[model samples]
Target: MSDSRSGLFGFVLNGLGHMFRGGLLYWAWLALLLVLIVLGGWHYYLQLRDGLLVTNMSNQVSWGFYISNFTFLVGVAAAAVMLVVPAYIFNRKDIKDVVLMGDTMAIGAVAMAILFVVVDLGRPDRFWHLIPFIGRFNFPESMLAWDVIVLNGYLLLNFGISFYIVYNHYQGKEPNASRYFPWVLLAIFWAISIHTVTAFLYSANSARPYWHNALLAPRFIASAFASGPALMAIGLQIIRRVSDYPIRQSVIDHLALVAAIALQVTLFFVLAELFTDFYNEGEHAASARYLFFGLDGHTALTPWIWTAVLLLAVALLILMIHPLRTHPVYMNIAFVLTVVGVWIEKGMGLVIPAFVPTPIGEIYEYAPSATEIMVSLGIWAIGLLLFTLLAKAALPVQCSFLREKAHREVTHDDA
Candidate 1:
């Protein structure tokens, strides 16, 4: 037992060593992320010193870029379910090879999501108030409390599962499925719950009629499915090119198919929502009007919403067509489009619109100030940096495990 523990410790140290060693481009990438982090950290310091006045948020439109990003990232984190479901439940060998990347992504994304929430708080010091026993933690009633639970719970689940699998791989042993399979099942359901709870956080706001719809949760899930797989597909291709990890074309193709179908469902939801809002335009339709078109000459988000629509439309066209979806170049193009389009639609288009024509019948146009932009970029850079390091460390161990498995299989065949 002592020797085994020592071996595991050594394996971890070796993985850490590999994380720090890389080529010039890899170092440059890390350097760029560091620079962005510094710039963002500097701007965040300014915001902390001066308060939210440094941001464009106000009484009329309180949730701005920070919450927008938090909302989108929750979906990205939840999207890991796409990979997990196939790899474990259906037992797809191709997907199993790269599912660790999905877990890594969820870790980075949830970290960012939590960071965004922390930064958005006017008093970051008072965050302990959300703690269960130590803080107020009005659970079962407050949706924010629920959000706190699901997000943290989901994060812990992924971290525990990933650590188990990665540690086993590093020790040159296959993880026993029975030991971890139940957790995988829970993580899958927990993934869906995280996003659903997030949506409920917004929809529970009875004052915001725009977000107070039953459809919001389903819309969140659909859009999440689209964006999450699109991102994983892109990451899988990059890993295939950069490492000897044996990420199969079948995995990429599977992810693309999921993204395409989810994109269709997402577009349908959007259309249905538009019709519901416009078919009998009235007081409730005010927010929709302010978003897509101009309301009382306040056209700030009009162009932005239309631009998002155009991007999603174009991406949908590209992804839905079979030939284009199968073509590597066109498929990648569609993936990029889907990510950006969903980012804009779910981020700016969703969060900002609901607050446009405030409850008091006053319109306030809001945009992220330079400080908000810089801080947001910094948070994003932090997530990317975390993912880069985690992937760098885990990929080598994964590759080694695959080689060992192949050898064992050949040996068994010969015997």
Candidate 2:
């Protein structure tokens, strides 16, 4: 028993060792992320010191860039289900090999989502009030309580599952399927709930006519499916180029197909929403107008939304066409455009519009102050750095250990 415990401890130490052993380019990349983090950290300090006054968020638009990012990342974190469903439930071996990457991405994304929420709060130190058992958590009543539970639960689920698999791989053994499969199933459902609950949070706001619609949750899920897998596909391409990992082209193709279909569904939802809003041309339509064309003369978000629409439209065209989708160049282009388009649409387009022409019919155009932008940039850098370190450590255990295990099985069979 003591030897077994020591072996597990040693394995952890070895993984930590991998985090610091990369080449000059890898180190340079780490340095760049660190610099950005420092700059962001410095700005965040300023915001904390001066209060949210440093940001452009006001009573007219209470939730600004921070919540916008938090909302989008919730979908990104939940989108891991896209990969999880196919890899585990359908038993796709190619995708299963790299699904750990999706889990790792979820961990980073959820962490970032949580950080965005923290920064949005006026008194972040009071965050424990949201803790159900310890604090004054309103759980079962407060949607924020539900969000806290799901985001943290989802983060732990991914971390636990990844650790189990990677630890087993390091031990030169296959993870017992029965032991982990049930948890994988739970993670899949939990992933969906995370985003669904987030959507409900918005839709529950009856005062905000822009968000008080039945279609919000489905729209969230659809856009999440497009953005999350699209982002993962980009990461996989990078991993393929940079490492000796045996990521198959088929895996990338599968992700592209998922993103393409999801993008189509997302666009349809957007069209449905637009038609519903403009058909009546009432007070509720005001927010949609501000988003797409602008409300009254305040056109702050008009250019941004149009740009997102154009990017998504072109991306859909590229991905839907057989030749373009198959070509690596075009496929990558579509993936990049899909990610950026969804970020703008789901982040700025969704969040800001709801508050615009506020319920009392006040017009205050809110933009992210330089401070908000810097803090957001810093938070993003932190997530990227976390992912980089995690992938650096886990990839060898995942790729090399599994490959060696497979090789031994084949050799024994031949003998």
Candidate 3:
């Protein structure tokens, strides 16, 4: 036990030192993250002091901005698997080169996702309520329980894989493929399960007709593909620009194509939903009408939904044109557009509608208050900062691993 404790202490100290070690850019990034985290902590403190009353949430619309962001971040976390499929399964060189980035991205994304869930819980101090032995756990009964379990499981799996491989490379040692690849394959399946389970959480609510569709899971997955790839594209481009690590154009091209196709599929799902709602025009369409148009003078969410749709259309156009997808400037612009579009569509756009025009005919519009916004911004800061640090540490290890692999190959040939 003493030896284990010593090793654990040394490991943590080494990690902290590595994460904080860098020049001006690093410090500047760290400073920005610190400021945001402080703001979020202050906001969360206010929430704890006053209770959930500080937020604009009510019985009519219980879900708010925090849950919306959580939903979107889950998709981002799952998107890391796109890299794994091609790199591990198909043996793509470009993807193999930057797979570590995706794993680190997953770690950051899952961390933020969990934070958002906790922030939305309102009484986070009582978090032990979800504990199994000591507290009540719903398990198969509560989809929320499934979500909590899957999210944490996925987080641990990715973090473990990333830590082992990256640490080995950092120490100038090669990672054992047999030890990690099986876990990598399992992670891909778990990634999909996370989002699908989240979708089921919404879909199971029979009162929320808007979320009751069979296509809801598919919609979540497709939109996730679009937004997740967009994020990966942007991050990889940044890494390519800043570091000596090589990110090939082929990887960018493949990501863009995958995002483009998924965006088109997402558009189809939206169109199908729109038709079903408009064609029948029953009580079930109330939320859809509220979202697209105004339902009984409740036009609060109309602008947001329309803006998201417009952004989706613009992004689709950029991807449809071969020239635009190939152009670095246009491709990057499309990536940003798709990410924002999906966040609005799959996140707020989906969550808010389910609650509007409540089951008993309530029309209380929910908007996130200033405190909520600050808390969210702070959570975002935490996530981005985590990603920045992970990427920063990951790059050197990845580059060295690549160099060492190449050296071994050359030596083998000479011998």
Clash count list over all predictions: 0, 0, 0
Candidate 3 backbone collisions, by pair:
none
Q: How accurate is candidate 1 locally (lDDT)?
A: 0.91
Q: Which structure among the candidates has the greatest lDDT?
A: 2
Q: Over all chains combined, what TM-score does candidate 2 have?
A: 0.98
| Candidate 3 segments whose C-alpha is farther than 4 A from its true place | 1-15
Residue 175 in model 2: shift from native, Å? Answer: 0.6
Which digits, one per residue and each the tens of the lDDT, describe model 1 over residues 1-415? 2456538677678778888999898899999999999999999999999999999999999999999999999999999999999999899998998999999999999999999999999999899888989988898999988899899998899989998898888777899999999999999999999999999999988888889899999999999999999998998889888778899888988988998899999989989989999999888889999999889998988888888788888888888898998899999998998898899889998999899789879899998999999999999999999999999998998898899999999999999
Q: Tens digit of lDDT per residue, candidate 2, span 211-311?
A: 99999999999999999999999998998888888899999999899999999999999999999999878998999999888878899999999999999
Is candidate 2 or 3 superior in TM-score? 2
TM-score for each candidate, following the candidate numbering:
0.98, 0.98, 0.95
Q: Which scores better on TM-score, 1 or 3?
A: 1
What local distance difference test score does each model get? Answer: 0.91, 0.92, 0.89
- In candidate 1, residue 111 scores what lDDT? 93
Order of the predicted models by lDDT, top scorer first: 2, 1, 3
